[model samples]
Target: MRELTESETRVLFEKLSKYIGRNITDLIDRPDEPFCFRLQKDRVYYVSEKLAKLASNVSRDNLLSLGVCMGKFTKSGKFNLHITALDILAQYALWLKPSGEMSYLYGNHVLKAHIQKMSEDCPQHQGVIICSANDQPMGFAVSARAAVECKTLEPTAIVGYHQADLGEYLRGEETLA
Candidate 1:
């Protein structure tokens, strides 16, 4: 990812703050230095550290990736948000029903009946921070339909897939660390 210009960084932060309902320009732009990085023309990554003094460009394969705390990148350049980084802006979260939570936590898409709650604030098909009925954030999901139509969704209809989940921590991999 390449370092963004000051103007470019401010623009991005403004857009994100609107979506999450807060002016969080300072959240991604540290007081001491910058925290935003351009992953391409349309996508960007936000880390917790100030790396501009060390380097300007950091790609996915670079070892410097260790400094990346979290990020929001575009998907097909349609919208800017990566499903995994949902926790940072989780205030406008979607709370799923128990059944729906189970389906999603296991890597399956969420169904209509599984949706216990969600904010009417979200637009249709937008990436959302998802949580279980208990308020535990499961991960991210693309809204299958708008709030008005969510109730009418078929039980078998898939809402959205998990962009990230805690279950993966115990998957086939074997590690003691």
Candidate 2:
């Protein structure tokens, strides 16, 4: 495990900021305990300072993982946010209709007809947290159309592209363990 380099930090934050926006600061400057990001096997872990310090005592070979597995960096250096980071992104998310929830969970793109509502300022291609009507975080997606555009679009028009979803937890159970 090691610290993220300057370039890696930039890449990671750029991907995260797309979904959570300025809330990234709240992750760093927390009221309870300070948390930090650490890299282990290309996967970024969001760990508390105390736990990270304790984890430092263990050798790299034996430490399988640290805290929450935020995501991983590809060989090409692109960061992919994992479903595990949903808790943090849930704060500012796009709410979907109940009809859309199942489709999204099945890894299908969100259709305009399924959208209950979205943020007023949501723009096309922006990363957004996808939630159910009950406000449950379902996954993450990239908006396919701007808020205004959706109003004039057909019901079957794509509104969001699935990036990651909770269904992955069950589908990739073997790999997750």
Candidate 3:
């Protein structure tokens, strides 16, 4: 995966910093120095002493698992899922390994084009899917089942910028099931 350009990195940091204001201190467990930040419920939570202590003990492998698990849990029972991660290209391997039902729309072109087409094709049902920048379709069968089980047929849309790490495609499978 390509490293983010300096400008892109700066943009990411700026956005993160804006959300970390005031709570910046909470991210550091030790008063003298600190490392790492926590994300919770679409919000970045500054780690307090207690939380930091727990984070410190977590291993790298465990941390990766935790991240995937968190992503899965956050997605719970949604009929249609849309994820848009800035670092998707770099983190695809670790991010898309969880077990669950989901539909990941990756890449700006595919996502945008698909959404536009879906919009033009199905205009009646709207506001069904919520988009995010950090979701990936992992399990093909599971996602198909979820999509079929979903009561609402409202079209959903997502926007991403990379195509390499989007995982498997299960579009028509849902309708067949």
Candidate 4:
């Protein structure tokens, strides 16, 4: 994947700000701050943190995954590209292995915790966590039901399957494009 030029980055940020109805001037004054000030305060920091991680990866999958994670976690309710938060968290766990702070189980647990937190804090976003936890078959069934309801109210991209496949597909790939 081609690295985004400085101008492209600026344009992309502007577009995102506009799409979310955030004032560009406010964001310029505090670039480190989140775009979702009151609508979904928790999501602002969550998204900013995810973007910081994506900035280090050269793969398109990684970038897309980051975008999906942001959209899912924030429950933006628009399908762009389906990327699962579990996948990103799992990758972070692997990267943090050297620090001995996280194992696969630990990572999975953290993912579950985050999902649960999101569900509790944002009832409207509860389906996002449910859908991403669908690897558990039973969870998937429940999520599917929730998703059906969510879909009637608003469109949400399904991401669990896509995220599950990304790790395998990118394993030996030479380029990101």
Best-fitting candidate, scored by lDDT: 2
Cα lDDT tens digits for candidate 3, 26-102 = 43355655543344333223333344566657664454322221121134322222232222112212122111113
Clashing pairs in model 4?
none
**Candidate 2, residues 1-177: lDDT per residue as tens digits?**
888999999999999989878789999889999999999999999999999999999999999998899999999999999888888779889888998899899989999989998888888899999999998899999999899888999999999999989998877889975
Candidates by TM-score, descending order: 2, 1, 3, 4
Q: Alpha-carbon error at 20 in model 4, in Å?
A: 6.7
Question: Considering lDDT, which of the candidate structures 1 and 2 is the better prediction for this target?
Answer: 2
Q: State which candidate has the highest TM-score.
A: 2
Full candidate order by lDDT, most accurate first? 2, 1, 3, 4
Candidate 3: regions farther than 4 A off: 1-12, 15-49, 54-108, 116-160, 163-177
Choose 3 or 4, whichever is better by lDDT: 3
lDDT of 4 by residue, 107-126 (tens): 22212222311221222212
Q: What lDDT does the true structure give each of the candidates? A: 0.62, 0.91, 0.29, 0.29
Candidate 2 at 3: error in angstroms? 1.6
Please, what is the TM-score per model? 0.59, 0.91, 0.22, 0.21
lDDT of 3 at 101: 16
Q: Quantify how close model 3 is to the true structure by its C-alpha RMSD in Å.
A: 15.2
Query: Candidate 2 overall Cα lDDT vs. reference?
Result: 0.91
Model 1 CA deviation exceeding 4 Å by range: 1-3, 6-68, 72-84, 172-177
